[model samples]
Target: MDRRLRSILKELIQAKKALTSKFIANINQVTPRTTQEDIKKLNQQLLSHGASIQSIKGRGYHLHIEDEQLFRHFLTTALYENKDQKQIPNTPDQRVRYIIQKLLLTMDYLKLEDLADEMYISKATIQNDMKLVREHLSNFYLDIRVKPNYGIRIIGEEMKIRFCMAEYLIQRGSDSNGNIYDGFIRLPKEQTDFIKQTIIAHLEKQHMTLSDIAIQNLFIHIAIAVLRIQNGHPVDNDANPKQEITHTKEYKVAEKIVGDTEQELGVIFPPTETSYVALHLLGTKILTTADIEKNQDIESLLDPAIYELVIAILDRIELEMHLNIRHDRDLMINLGLHLKPAMNRYKYGMNIRNPMLESIKKNYQLAFQAAVHAGVVIEKYTEVTIDENEIAYLALHIGAAMERQKLKQGPKRCLIVCASGMGTSQLIYYRLKTKFNGKMDIAGTTEYYRLSTYPLDDIDFIITTIPIHEDLGIPVVEVNAIISKDDLQHISSYIAGTPSNVIRDFLQEDYLFLNQSFHAKEDVLAFMVSEIESDDLKRARFLESIYEREKIAPTAFGNLVAIPHPLTPQSQQTFISIATLTEPIPWTTERTVQFVLLLSVKKNSVEDLQPLYEMISKLIEHPESLQKLMQMTDKASFMSMMETLERL
Candidate 1:
């Protein structure tokens, strides 16, 4: 019962088709031999649950379950409750079937003698395993056909065979000690030897050490990744969009080793199962920082944003360690420096000893600001936190900064201008409108027919998508018919030169309202509970208790709106009920609040605070609009009106 196997079977059942061994092998990175065995074991296990595996003469296997819903429930009950552990049902026959299916996936046709050797039992025991497999298949025409040449192959309907196989392997397997790791390793002697040789050969290049057990575990990781990827599961490592050649090559080498080992041991590491184990092993081994830098070409392969983050981190580490610390360079020293102090502080049971170290590493925001101030080459988030209307202004600043830094940004917003009266202006406006989506905002498409007309105010930059008869007293880039990228690039250079002192000053003003008025426990609770029905009295009492321990800080968030809530909570769920003042009540002894949001939650569930904060921020984005919403005569009307407004 491998986790990956269970997942793959579930995916197959969802897909409603019998997948080929070739597809499963490619995903699992197992050899054709191993896949066949895995399918056989899966079939044997499925029989106990009124399931069967059938193999169409030339086609691959498919699983047939008598009760799909019941099977899913049984699986959920068995696996989901304690998802991290690897425990199948209590039936001995089911357990035997599980082991046999896993072995089948690793070998083509495991002989009775080979099975006996691996299981530490006699020939009779090996035969009994097969007997249980057949008993499970008694309901169907499916039979384990034996050949002097091929050994054993399941024969029957393709759909049933594949379904049973997928169901068995989709679960995570349990070790003798009940540990779960992706999938289990059930390798024969030759295959095990070959895998070790392949691993040793590759590790020699890096001079790394890995035990035999580590090698098998490495294979299991790869096998799981391959299977998950094929079944459309999101893998943590696969998020990296880079093409890893050295890593991929190493996996190929592992596959070859497995094949060679299987041949030597007179076991089958069929072609279907080889690649998954190899790639998975290769990928997992290089997860360390040194390995990634050494093997991965991030500069050439990764996105600029990601690459900059990596460089920024490395630069910080290099500055501290006095070492270049390239991607591939050993990071053990730096990692140790960070981890040892934390471990020591915890071991000694003291919190105050590591103040300076924590200050440098803990404040990530300050660290980023430090990096920016130090002239470190990096990309900044283009859209800074500002008013919705101010986004266009911020965009101009971003364009300017990108130009100054010689960086590229897509889609330029252009302002078109002309004299107030003509057909020429209308013509340019129509063409530009048809050409670009409002990505290019025509601040004002003016007329050439009139000389002195409408005033063009607050135009950051302009692009005349058409030629002008007069200069129009502004920097203009003339285009023949359509606006070219080159024109936008030229405009970007000019826009970058505009003064940013005004925007910077606005940001520096500190618009955030800090500690304001604190409300009484009973008064606020009565206010909050007034909005809900009497049936929700328990909820009101809970909010009262939350307020008793933690005070509600009411901020006069300007524009006549006030959001009231305790910083921490002690409720089961986040109650986002609203309160409105009949009269404009002076909230902070200065500003008044007509609208308020009372956020209350249980103290232990501190994490729920963020969503309420964000929702409140979005609600108060437009103060004037909110003031209008709050003035509604009825509570139901106000609630109805508030529901229509979108949260950021």
Candidate 2:
């Protein structure tokens, strides 16, 4: 196939969508009939190469690559090498032959005309090209067959195919074992014998202690270091040559990677020695007329310690599990693309769906909005498939924002009141601080009876463990000592905001009750039960019983947050109740609970609990939203407020 035509087909494959006949027409706009003929020819060629072309009756053609995994296997072994290879100098015909060989390794069949166009030659020229490919590659018994009207095909022994590939890669200046030691001279006879003896002794117990290629690369490195020292360069203590070395950015990258590798592997690799070897192989004097860094910058970053550690790890895996992790970029990238999220969750000590996930969630709706506003239309090449994971991510973000708004509503100064002097008072103080953190300036702890007598000049809010009878000229939030981290975070969120002093305005001395409703459940609970199913509520109530027992330790996990959860499953239904206090009350000594969510879980289903927790955690974040919610009198209004909060 011609080089130009091959490039065109490859581009189409990457496009990921169907091509219109018009699109193909545009590609060969100058000569429509000729291009049509070319397309037919390319299709035939593809079939011969163990691949096929899918042509929509009305639409255009698409390449259907077969045996993709086999193709990758072939490419890895055939086109690439584990180490460096010499750059082959040859004629253009040789280069063309090399290109054809490498392309075949892709295992993607191409049309003859397309191949001809890629090579920028005529059909006759392609025929000649094929003759040369056959003449040289004949010993490998690789057949390059042309099916005139169909296309062309190359067939042969898979092993020989790989050998041809290795040859092509070496000729193309690829790093392979064959030429790894090209520039390095042999060590002194005694030194050489000693090195071999040492390697043999080390490998006696393991037949594959080191690959033939690895040993050769190691020798090259050592030999290059020796040559640099012998050539009158300043010799370091380690017998490495040191010249007028300047640390460029690339070298800095090398230094950083080397340091990381050394720490991880626990071995010291002298920079001077590595630098000499690198310079000998890739330096300006050896391979090029002018000095320039090439592809091997990454290779130079390999410290001996890290390299050896990697080898050792690979060796163990092969021995113990019989699993080989290909060190190639494509394989590693594919693996990493899958493993990164798992690793991130593990390191951060977060659940799969973390409450804080909202902060980092991608707002696709917002993105679409922006795109439309900017008059930009997305030209999707592939089918627009919905990603469930992405939806979950967005949901997490929304949940986090809801939780944040709850924390943003509290005032700076708050006074903690309780019947007990320092014991309960101190617990209240600590809990408030845990929730509000830098946001709250706790006035002090005092008895509720002291409120009228005590100066209330700077107290923005008052929190009490026990209910008070007299109007204290401040908003008083009564709470139980045992509170969850979720509730505390919600309360801290409210205390952080500058909501109106409803305590001073709404509380009447006559309305004050010592044992006034500590928890207002009539309306809010009704609202939850109305919105959520009966089963959900029952599950939530069951979960709450477990939480009651586990109240032995407060769930105040700092950041002005508390997670009120049942320790075990006992409920038939689950519902979350969110409460934001005007002032944060003492839930416990370890944390405070101003915002309380009673989780009633049913069926002990982890799946059901995930969504409930996700939603509650997200909702507790908004201070203004919670305050608005608290002020709502009707169910409809509250639901509307929730909807608005969800929009946020």
Candidate 3:
């Protein structure tokens, strides 16, 4: 099968629900008609395998498996066949990446004609690909220049060239079983193994717990450094001469690791090389609970400024996102510990490569956004711009805390007040218990007459069979004596509370701006701010805060969505003003945002906005809904669709 077919199959396999033709087309950057044809051809190929694509009229296409073993075998064989059958680049983007990788791997000048011949493309096509190659290399601060007699060569600082090689030259290796191999540099397997084992032994001795991906990243860095040094390209000593790094314990550890490798591999590394490895150690070490000594104060162990900064970040996150993770002491310590070395990296302009950045962004978007907020705080204090990779690492710390909070929250406690006799109440109780399972904790049952004498102090809400018109301090959900699916849904609605309720309450018709023609993010923000009925000073401050947040990181969350908000609350009342552009506007280099949700919280407000943010995140996840919202010409249709979507 072709690359596009494989891409479609992968998308179908990974999708949680059936993927629409439009969604698949968007992903493949093609028209729906073209995608449909591709799907038809893919289905033809799958007939020999054990899977087929089922098209649902007016819905989408779903992948059906007839035999799992056969399907798995087919996938393996197909992948192996593709691997063995090396072919030239067939697309412009692929050709660009190919040229970039080729140029980065070789030190000598590469002839344009040679590249054209290798890819079986014309010289003009090769020239166009080189233009893209230069554009991509510019991001790494590398330049591609052509000599009069010689061909094109990549010229840059040695360290930058190494960084580019680390990013582009080596292939992201994987095994036959689809396992990713860490040895990417062109070193012998035994040598790579020796370096990895050396680092592992020393890390174990120091009781440091770096993640697998972190270990692999460190291994790759050291391997590349060794290869580059052997080729007479040592890192410049004057790049960053922070004497404090030499005094740190990680520096000593790095020295020992490099010393052992140098003896084994017969290559000598300078003091700067040791410091470079130590910087990696400092940035990637995962803090275990054992790191904190018993009865030792965390604040005393961490830098005072970082500790305070972490606290401030948590406070701001709680105030804005209302994640309820401010009291997570473990999170505070982790963030503080991470910030110490991260601050060092930022101070010296060191880059820490995060291999799991893409996965983290896709899987933990809400947490990533919260981390972006944290990054803003870091930028304010450190006066350094934090990249997405660093922001993603911070997100991991915050995501873990959010997960811990979920595991610690137990379940919702509710009391069942059935008007029927004990027998019927018992039936209802068993049904709810079986349905909700671990999601709910039953606080026992009681009859309506006995409810007045029952203790309601420990209950979060009351589930009753019949309506009781009495004032209670908790929410009461009414259902039938025998719980039906609709009754359970009603209880669920009461329990989770459809985010549409919050959206409807906060998103007023006057505040909603649909199909607005704005070319830039600033224009969109200014228009949205003007629409808000607030004082001039507060409006100006709010606009300034939006720009300040943008400087730290753009608010574009991808999927054609951008949620722009101030760093802090700037209004007397919290509200969300939404503006959907007629055409997608550039919010960032990688993201063109069509839907902009401008959020402003009430000043000094303690209200929980988690549901509001959750709703926005949910909307971001559904591209179909975004497309539908963008197509809506009137507010009524948009509101109706939003309400329907919230229930789904």
Query: Estimated TM-score per prediction?
Result: 0.22, 0.20, 0.74
Relative to the unseen true structure, what is the C-alpha lDDT of residue 235 in candidate 3, on a scale of 0 to 100? 84
Residues 194-260 of candidate 2 have per-residue lDDT tens digits of 4334433433433223334334433443433333334443224443333333254323433443354
Give the poorly placed runs of model 2, Cα more than 4 Å off.
Answer: 1-563, 585-593, 604-618, 630-648
Q: What is the C-alpha lDDT of each candidate?
A: 0.43, 0.42, 0.77
Q: Write the residue-wise lDDT of candidate 1 on 333-359 in tens digits.
A: 222222222222222221211112212
Q: Number of clashes in every candidate structure?
A: 66, 80, 0
Off by over 4 Å in 1: 1-202, 205-218, 221-248, 267-274, 281-648
Candidate 3 all-Cα RMSD? 6.8
Where does the lowest 10-residue lDDT sum fall in candidate 3? 175-184
Residue 562's lDDT within candidate 1 is 55
lDDT of residue 298 for candidate 2 = 24
lDDT per residue (tens digit) for residues 1-648 in model 3 = 766788788877765567778667655555789899999999998888999999988668889999999999998876546443444565565677677777766777989998899889999878877777887788678899898667998898877887777676444543312222222235666787788899999999987777665677677778888888888888888885537678888888999999999999999998888887888777556555566756368787677898889988898788767777998888888888778768767776666677677667666766887898888778777788788888888999999998898687767799999877889989999999998898789999998888899988888788898988886756677889878898888777655544326667688889999999999998989989987876633778889998877766567776678888887777767788889887766675445778898888766554545566667767767765766687678999888887666655
> Highest lDDT: which candidate?
3
